[model samples]
Target: MASPESRIIELASRIAANTKKLNDYLVANNLPTPSFDVKGPKANLVPKQEIEVQAARAAIIDDTQELRRLVLGPREYLMSYTHNELISQQAITRFGIAHSFPVGSEASFAEIATKTGLPETNVRQVIRHAINKDIFVEPRPGVVAHNAVSRLLAEDKVIHDWVGASTDDLWQSASQTCNALTKYPGSQEPNETGFALANNTKATVYEVFSQFPERARRFGNAMRSFTEGTGFELSHVVDNFPWGDLPQDGVVVDIGGSQGFVCFALAAQFPSLSFIVQDLEPVIRAAEKQPQAIELGTDRIKFMTHDFLTEQLVHGADVYFFRWILHNWSDKYCVRILRNLIPALKQGAKIVINDNVLPKPGVMSKWQEDRLRSMDLTMTELQNSHERELEDWAELFKLADPRFEFQGGELPKSANLWVLVAEWKGE
Candidate 1:
């Protein structure tokens, strides 16, 4: 039999190899690749980046083989549940293994175990493991407590399923111990089901949003924060665009325009243009009650209850606007949604999709790219949709409507999100 150290090294080597193979496959398929840059930019090659990459490679390969062993080899399924076990431990560290009280603070294992209804040994083990990962901390030996990262979960209100949750929150989208490719057993083209499993209802995402009402409200609240911090930059940056070139009054419509936030922002900048906001009934109801929105009166701004998938109600609008919406559906469904808008577009209508388009291969930093891809998986596992790269978006448009041609442009200077403007030119 192999020595223990030899086994460990072998496992790491396998992981590294697996990561590389999958990473290579993804690259070949024109998909996103997780960054494992072991070397920084160097002519002769650097050691640090190489080391990290090697480690990542080893982990991926070993994890994959271990997972295979659990499923296909003689190993019992007991260890197959490791990811789920980690998820449970993670939840305890965030939601309270002992009590829902502050984690990582000066709390004894006995007290925490009693509060959480977990075994004392299990509680101790979870806390100890969490501490090592910095999920929580030990102010002193045996005294564990939550830290700031853990505190994100310690909130009374569940803003998003991820609120106050540990890093395992990422796993809530799917409980699979192995990657989705291995879990679903060969159904791997990337669609809404996978996206939803990874995001919308991920235990962490659920922890953040809770239920539908709360989810909608928190979604708006999150966006509100994003707008406040980045709105000025976007407004100023987008304002420089040729709004004058867009259609006149009755030409542009904002789909899913909750509370007229985007319209309000745009109206302030372009006083001459008319705007229409279409959304769900509840959102429209809420928008009607906002003091400023109600105060704005209802002239050019008309609120209507329309579902984008059912039909395109806003006909002949010179432009259709969808902001941060498409990343929530499968490619097929997204194509369906885009096709639904076809009839509403006249000869020259433009569709502006203001959402984060995953960057082209190697264009973005690995961290950002991985973050987005992880989000894509999260969405697949949760709400059943995902963010797509520019090529994905363009191809989707072409698939849905051959008459429509996509044009990519540099988003306004302050815009963190990218834009893919689809123009319907085949009158």
Candidate 2:
């Protein structure tokens, strides 16, 4: 009998096939090919709406990763261990090396050192290390220029904030997570987290950020950066949910909605539905000045200064919405957040959530799974919270209140966040 095909060969074969398919699609659509050059596209040109083309691109990534792993073998893979991977990136963001020179111009190590106030030798070492990761390109023996990645660091404020937050906040917290866990075993308080430990404080990350506006803005923009990618698009929420089914005068109270970005999108799509966006005073103040909020505030969307953890104030709304919010809190706090809404919830009112839903293991590609799993760990590291499966969402509502009739949810195709709705069955 013929032996089963080897794993590496199978992966390589799949990689080649998918690569051809993706390339064909790109060429057919007049889309540019992927590149690390400064002029290259910042994102995959294959649109998420094109399922076949996007799947081909995704398969190529998964197969290539698997092929590399198989070729590495177990011992060699074990040899790849290290914890200092974020060091150069940390230096880059902390020192603002990406901004030390013009994107289109080349800079020598000494020149960058002069601009960023770093020792020339250290700048040379850090940038050379970053070069290996494609952050910048060394065009000559002593001079460097921007690649697409480093160009982004210099030009995209949100992306820069994301990198800075990931390096300065998340990486430090990650290193201390195990130590924090060991010290405070089974702790669920947000203050009892790696973030708290890293900051050498008992306060939670949010509490710490509240004391520093610039840092908080960076963190906020870091979160906002994800919305630019696939699945985080507001269009997914607008298109997937049945907002059209609401009564002509239906109201959606967006609990903890910062900047009302989601409500702005929803208000545009469903003119029949009005919105009340509630957040803390600072967030409300910021949202009130945003162009979208200014435009939408005319008749449909109203902004309110409130906090989700406090008693919910807006009463008898048709729908209450939470997007990218609940997963940041531990189950204890999530239950409380839901309970706070009970006083405001009308009979037959709906609590609709747009958030991450952990998939069953092996349900997604490794690339996708790694991202979700890392996010799960991050929630734990920062807030003692965790991503939930569909079952967990059902159980969470039931635990919150018996009247919160737990309804099953759906993850829209190619979208990262799921849409779950639970109806209040109050008599």
Cα miss at 113, model 1 (Å)? 3.3
Scanning candidate 1 in windows of ten residues, the lowest lDDT window is 38-47
lDDT of 1 by residue, 177-213 (tens): 2345455553423432333454633343334454556
- Runs in model 1 deviating more than 4 A are 1-89, 97-105, 155-170, 176-237, 247-250, 383-386
Which portions of model 2 miss their true places by more than 4 Å? 1-5, 289-299
Q: How many residue pairs of model 2 clash at the backbone?
A: 0
lDDT of 2 by residue, 34-72 (tens): 898999888778777898877787788888876776677
Per-model TM-score versus the true fold: 0.65, 0.93
Q: What RMSD value applies to candidate 2?
A: 2.3
Candidate models: Cα lDDT each? 0.61, 0.88
Q: Evaluated with TM-score, which candidate comes out highest?
A: 2
The predictions' CA RMSDs to the true structure, in order, are 10.9, 2.3
